[model samples]
Target: MAGVFMISDHHFGHKSIIDFESRPFADADEMTETMIDRWNAVVGKDDKVFHLGDFSFLNREKTTAIVSRLNGYKTLILGNHDRGRSRAWWLETGFQEVSEYPIVYGGFFFLSHEPMYMNKHMPYVNIHGHIHGQKYEGNHYFNVCVEHWDYTPVAFEEIVRRVVPSEEQ
Candidate 1:
């Protein structure tokens, strides 16, 4: 089976993100290239990647070019910064699917761009981004931002391992 991965808040071509997030890239171009290289290293052409949001801040042509260079069948869950754009715009950028609302995946994970509040009593967990370096309390919330991850897409199995006990797995 093709691997399933998740990532968020790439902010490609956004120079300020480097300063704001303290990303180690020298510039937007460098950040974009490094991120593409890192993404391709882990995600295969046939893999599915769920991008939680804020994929890029580049223009249409550049954004499309960057998206085309990445390896994966991409799905985007629109973030706050992703707004003010049409669905057609995102589709043209190469995302296979785009959603403005949260989606329940595998009947267990609630996927969204922004973190949702849920308690331990809830049966499902929220896998989201938008908080950047801010920490989310409790096991019910998992942040998939590039800052939280090693600036790469993470496998669903890894997320499961972090959230689920060995006995349950």
Candidate 2:
């Protein structure tokens, strides 16, 4: 079986990635191409990729076209800035939206986006996006990278290190 993978917050076609996020690319087109190249490098034809959110900065047509070219069966968790059009388009392009997927996979809980507040929560870490590396720091919760420029999968162990207490580790 092919390996499973997850990534998010690519924000393709968004020129702000370079300016706002200080990404390496110079423009949205360049950034989009770079991300695609990186994703294809590690993802196989059969891999399962859970895209946390903000897949594109463009409209549904352009975003869906890009998604079609990428390898793997993709799933999306709607981000705060997501346009409903994109989600509707994704349904036709072999992508599903994870409203509240509750299943154990590889010994972890897979959440699309992290909730703001919770009284009781699952023992497993919530793999999510909206918050990148720096944003995750100091917070008790954990979030995985959606824009995996290298298509690298972050393990639950790494997240646990930050979110879980030392005593638990």
**For model 1, how does the per-residue alpha-carbon lDDT over 58-159 read when each residue is reduced to its tens digit?**
889999999999998999999998987887899999999999899899989999999998977997789999999887887899999999887899999999
Candidate 2 similarity to native, TM-score? 0.74
Candidate 2: segments with Cα more than 4 A from true spot: 93-107, 115-122, 137-140, 146-169
TM-score of 1: 0.97
Error of 2 at 15 (Å): 0.7
- CA lDDT scores, all candidates in order: 0.92, 0.63
How far in Å is the alpha carbon of 33 misplaced in model 2?
0.5
TM-scores of the candidates are 0.97, 0.74
* Model 2 lDDT at residue 60: 65
Cα error, residue 86 of model 2, in Å, equals 6.3
